[model samples]
Target: MKLVPLTDRVVLKQCEAEETTKSGIILASAAQEKPQEALVIAVGPGGVVDGKEVTMQVKEGQKVIYSKYAGTEVKLEGEEYIIVRQNDILAVVE
Candidate 1:
């Protein structure tokens, strides 16, 4: 099964959380914060949405930063993914 986003929705695979701090202190699982960065998995074709013409700026395989607390979590075939609106994506990592 595959995910096909509709309208301006986007699919992403989240990057793993860091287990240790920059100072070299190992953190517990509960203390690790989820990273906002993710890899673009799939993207929806952009068109008229909410009466506005939208164009997709992000592409599949691009790393991106998304808004915190955004998107819906999905589990597919033992793999986890995130689905969010294109607007929820903040920036693309170079």
Candidate 2:
């Protein structure tokens, strides 16, 4: 992928959770409770800082959970994606 996020923005590949519940309950696509968590794919170097470029704390492949409504959606190479800032990310998953 040739995607290079600008400023502190980061490109995240959303990970889809299972469509079925473990208790044998099937959920419809429209019934999803939250946006799937994601992985850090390509991240911007971080926003400008005091006249200098700051580096982001997030690295590629790191798992993160963000607001369900965050990010700008896009499609690249026929796959969907989301671009959000490092600060927008709520927490890093283990």
Candidate 3:
């Protein structure tokens, strides 16, 4: 099954957490912090939502940064994804 977001919602696949520190120290799994960066999987059509005229600025396949505590986690066909409102996306990575 495919995921289709609705109403300004965005679907993202989070980037993997770093296993080692920049100083070359390997960290345990429990110490790894989830990365805020992700690749855009799917995007919802932007329109009137909650009386606001919203337009989608991001597109599929773009890498983005989002709020630390945003979106809902979902598992589909053994793959994981996060769904969040467009506003939750902070910036798109070049």
Candidate 4:
């Protein structure tokens, strides 16, 4: 199944969390945190404004950093994903 967000919302696939530390030290399972970065998969059409339509600045395939609790979680095509407003995005990963 496919998800299509509405009105300035975006869908993203959460990136995998780091499994090891910088020094090649393996981290325990309990030390894992949800990855803050994600790959944008889909975006909504521009949200309506005062007699105008403002499109989203983010685009598909862009990697972004978002709030830890930014979006609503859902399962699609047997994989986990999230949907959030463009405003929820903190920054675009280079």
Candidate 5:
């Protein structure tokens, strides 16, 4: 099944955290931190939210940086994804 975000929500796939350090030492999974970078998979259409008109600034295929603790995690077709409000997205990577 495919995911389609509604309202100002955005669907994202988390970028993998580095498995090794620059020194070439492999880090264990327990030592790895969640990546803040993500790839935009889908975006919701802009509409009125909370009595205010909202516009989506990010688009599908764009790389984005989001708040560390933002969004909800979901699993679809064995792949993980996060669904968050557009406002939670801090910036779009150029």
Candidate 6:
């Protein structure tokens, strides 16, 4: 299944969190924090929302940083993804 965002929403795939530290010490899964970075899987078409004209700045394949608690999580085919509004995306990673 694929996600097709409506309005100014964006579909993102969470990037894998680091399993090891800089010192090469492996961390337990329970100790790992949910990563705030993700790859843009799909983008919504720009349109008027909330009485404001919104344009999508992120594109598919771009890595982005979003709010820690932003977006709704969904599981499809055993893979996880997030759906957040365009404004929730903080920055686009170069």
Name the best candidate (by TM-score).
6
What's the true lDDT of residue 40 in model 4?
Answer: 97
lDDT winner between 3 and 5, please give it.
3
Task: For residues 1-94, write the lDDT of model 3, one tens digit per residue.
Answer: 8999999999999987757668999876567678899999999999999999999999999999999999999999999999999999999999
Q: Is candidate 1 or 2 superior in TM-score?
A: 1
Q: What's the TM-score of each model vs. the native?
A: 0.88, 0.78, 0.89, 0.83, 0.89, 0.90
Clashing residue pair totals per candidate (backbone < 3 A): 0, 0, 0, 0, 0, 0
Candidate order, lDDT descending: 1, 3, 5, 6, 4, 2
TM-score of 5: 0.89
Q: Could you tell me the lDDT of residue 23 within candidate 3? A: 92
Q: What is the per-residue lDDT of model 1 for residues 1-94, given as tens digits with 9 covering 90 to 100?
A: 9999999999999987757678999776567778899999999999999999999999999999999989999999999999999999999999
What candidate 5 gets wrong by more than 4 Å, as runs, is: 26-30
Residue 75's lDDT in candidate 3: 99
User: Which 10-residue span in candidate 4 carries the lowest summed lDDT?
Assistant: 46-55
- Alpha carbon RMSD to native, model 4: 2.3
Q: List lDDT for all candidates, in order.
A: 0.94, 0.84, 0.93, 0.87, 0.92, 0.91
Question: Which residue pairs come into collision in candidate 5?
Answer: none
* True-structure lDDT of candidate 1: 0.94
- Model 4 CA lDDT for position 10: 92
- In model 3, pairs of residues that clash are none
> What does the lDDT read for residue 48 in candidate 5?
97
Q: CA shift at 1, candidate 5, in angstroms?
A: 1.7
RMSD of each: 1.6, 2.6, 1.6, 2.3, 1.6, 1.4
- Residue runs of model 4 more than 4 Å from their true location after superposition: 28-30, 49-53
